[model samples]
Target: MGDEAGTANQGAPNAGVSKSVSVRELVNRLKLEVIVGEEALDRPIRRSKVHRPGLEFAGYYDFFPIEHVQVLGKKEITYLHKLTHQERDERIGNVVKYHPPCFVVTWNQDGLEYLTAHCRKEGIPLLRTPQTTTEFMMLADGYLMKQLAPEIQVHGVCVTVAGTGILLRGRSGIGKSETALALIRRGHRLVADDAVVLKKVNPQVLLGTHNGTTREFLALRSVGLMNVVRVYGRGAFQDETRIVLDIELVPWKENELYNDLQLEPQTSEYMGVRVPCIQIPLQPGRDVAALIEAAAHNWYLQTQGYSAADEFMRRLQQQ
Candidate 1:
């Protein structure tokens, strides 16, 4: 499950910064044939949205999103076909001079000699796909959203426990992987081990996925690297999940105070999203796996507006 050649290097500048993808990567991922401008495949695509160049090709360039991947569908191409050669040349020529990131022709429309020629001369990559305009745009936009989404890689073990995504963080050899392995044995799903890539999908959502090379695999200190999917079937591993809780495993401090009564809420921020956080002290003979499972269940209950601590307080007040 190694990551594709270029995806490993696709990281944001800062923790919450936006990221860009290359035209070459999109070409490879989208299976688009490069009709022209092969040399310009290295151009950066900063925008995730694709634009249909109908307005721009009609000589209205104001507020044009030149950074977007220009898409030419049937209507746009047919409109171009309606124009005389000289008229088409002037309008599309103006477009080429702007040097938009790239152009994509969908539905395998022909009569793109001028478009291809202009793109090649201006060093703008022009690609063609057999998919319809709508399909191609949707696929490209979806991929771009994932690629350009704000992401941060953390050193932790992510697993799906009782339908809630929990990220376990702690010092080296603090039993993160071992705990995850135990949870997997209990019918939970392992998301990522060692390195988990967390992406902010929405303002309140943080999605976690495995590093490409480690997808569907976990490294146990006792057994080295093992494929969870191969050993436990597909149900044992998941590619990604929306992280909802953070569990920190720490060595037990003899004199340290612990939160026995969960009256107050604790949270930790990742990729600009705040997630419920709990600390479980690691000590000999402690069942950390069961504790984490309990934490997940507790968090799920909190989400549903039911907290045992709150209920207990209400009963005491009534008394």
Candidate 2:
């Protein structure tokens, strides 16, 4: 699942995982469980598994809180045995406190067979794999992560442009296209226009970009949709949107303290979900396009825990 209330990059931890799940689902992801040692079911797993797994294998932990881990291969046996008996006792204690992850692991077939025997011998279900440890962990992680990751409608956008999710929004007449055109002129590629699609992919990730139907170019008020590639060449266009700061367009209002938008940006409830929103009011003669681009890049700084508005407000309070 995901953390219910956090930015897209922060990745909320709860999407759909409840207090419990069906064994069938768990087995589908974890594949097999190998239970070793007679005391395996009695307490936590005594040995610590490898310190770090391969990147490809990190997805297998369905956020189970890592209650216990089994180190079965002979390579790790000496290191595991090096632990004091009391340390072993504490490690295994996590098993008693948490079930399911209590006892399971094997090195070679000998270890596997031993573990399998206890699981079957004691009526505990065990899973076996012909693949090596590396392959096994990958399969396990892939399955578990899929089971735990949130479901979102993705618009396929490159999100490496700073951290904030930047959304450009405005009415058809409001120069959303002209602003985007000018932004691209200023070097920020267009995300999506005409029809911008969005989706929440991971726990904290909200992906927005141009849909396949409209990825090629943007339509402007002064002109029709121009081919960015034709003008700026390649790398000037994209097919996705990462919605961090929402750049809004409306005729200028002198009464409105436009930039008072938000410094320590907070979530705005959209539909039933909450998302970070920044409102940028647009007006004529203000170079709306350049401002939107600047707003996006500035949002990056703010999201990095640097709040210009907050610091200014604090100083004003002191004065």
Candidate 3:
């Protein structure tokens, strides 16, 4: 399972903190074989970057980042093969002394006995992958970025309406899933229901997706569980999309005494990125689905520097 350390404490609506993943999780997710030091699987890989260790293995340890996962490719392994047994032992011993999170041998490890022995003795994890150097590095780096990325899980439904990712938040039994199902029937795509995992892959971009068995499924009140793909077809489900809008639904209240005119803009901050938020009060015959669709469309226009409300206000002021 993915790390839920960041999922437990979801602070005020949209605030989120950074996340971390253990070496054991990476090993299982990436399908890397544990060649030695299985006991050190609990090591925490603090850094997202993977080191090639070409220079380190070549007897140059200056500026080597031992906290990162080290990958040994064909070139690095070939270099070790060219060295005498004693030289190779000394070189590997030096690297093992640094105690990197783990060493991943890509493609094969036909001549890594010295390195493996030193790693096992020092209680350092040694992993191997059948993928080529480039392939393994690419996969590992991509997976690491996702696992190490700052994430926040929200109690909401994320759906794509008119190409805009909108997170619908509300209290329990507030029709969040119902609204999402309506949008999906209208040809929009559902990213997640019940629990939406938002990851800050980029500094300003937040991507929405679902974790575990919740993906591609929605739970309705009358209906127990329904698969979005089966009910609305395959086009109704999306793996992930950039979250751009946050819509909070509230039960209509009498004498709410709030601003009738939305003169002030509201935003929700998640993992340091701000997203535009709109609160819609739920009432009988409000056509919530259409309202959400319109909100998303308006937000999309706003991103392009166009605002209908602002334009209308400007014309009224001139009058």
Candidate 4:
């Protein structure tokens, strides 16, 4: 989760201020400053490296402010030199071409007057830090500050058991837990909930899960909170999952435009990964557990080159 090798002893002042943010959001704030002290950039901003401020810590920053990048003064910035004009031009090109940075950062204490004037002219937010690069990175990583791809919860567990990953996604309060509980009861393992962290392990492989604890936990509205690990034992908690198939649960609607009762399951798209999805609409009295088992069974069949949806469509073609 974070770098805990050493702690920041008698740390310097902190520059962070508060603004409501997720880990993903914080990384975006830092990256906005294309020009960070090279030494600072070399380190990280995750939580592990950065310790809480004190004699052994740098103290706490409220949070990152609206101004994205935090700048370190030259006295504060060491091991970083002025970028060559050519390098500056190239970096600037990248910045303008892809994403506009909020401001410039530097390591020159003497250059503060110059930086101030330039920032004012450019109208970008500016920040100063004294804790140096290494500490900043440790802190950032510990905070879980990393950019995220678009996230969507698939309706079920994506297991690596057979190599084809499955994603289970459903609306809030739709008994996703209840269904997952049944799957686990049937010997299927648990993965993540509320949010799933996915990384591009490779082109064909993706790692998905809640940080080990998220899966072994469930939140139920009617009965209050329950413990998955205590109730189901350690077999229920999975370290991670491979993503392949995504199942989405939708509530059944009588509205003609809102309903799709076709036997064929529809496909949904996200972050360029296309997955076979089962659209199970919720009803007051429907067998959800049976439906999910059937979906997994259906997925297994698809792996073996048999598709119930295709067969249903083929029958219509013949008719």
The models' CA-based lDDT, in order, is 0.85, 0.47, 0.83, 0.48
What's the TM-score of each model vs. the native? 0.80, 0.48, 0.73, 0.46
Report RMSD (Å) for each prediction in the order shown: 6.0, 11.0, 5.8, 15.4
Q: What tens-digit string does per-residue lDDT give for candidate 4 at 232-251?
A: 88876676766666666677
Model 2 stretches astray by more than 4 angstroms: 1-164, 254-266, 270-273, 313-319
The TM-score of predicted model 2 comes to: 0.48
Off by over 4 Å in 1: 1-20, 253-261, 283-285, 304-319
Best by lDDT: 1
Clashing pairs in 3: none
After TM-score superposition, the amount by which residue 261's alpha carbon in candidate 3 deviates from its true location, in angstroms, is 10
Q: What does the lDDT come to for candidate 1?
A: 0.85
Candidate 4 residue-pair clash tally: 40
Error of 4 at 92 (Å): 35
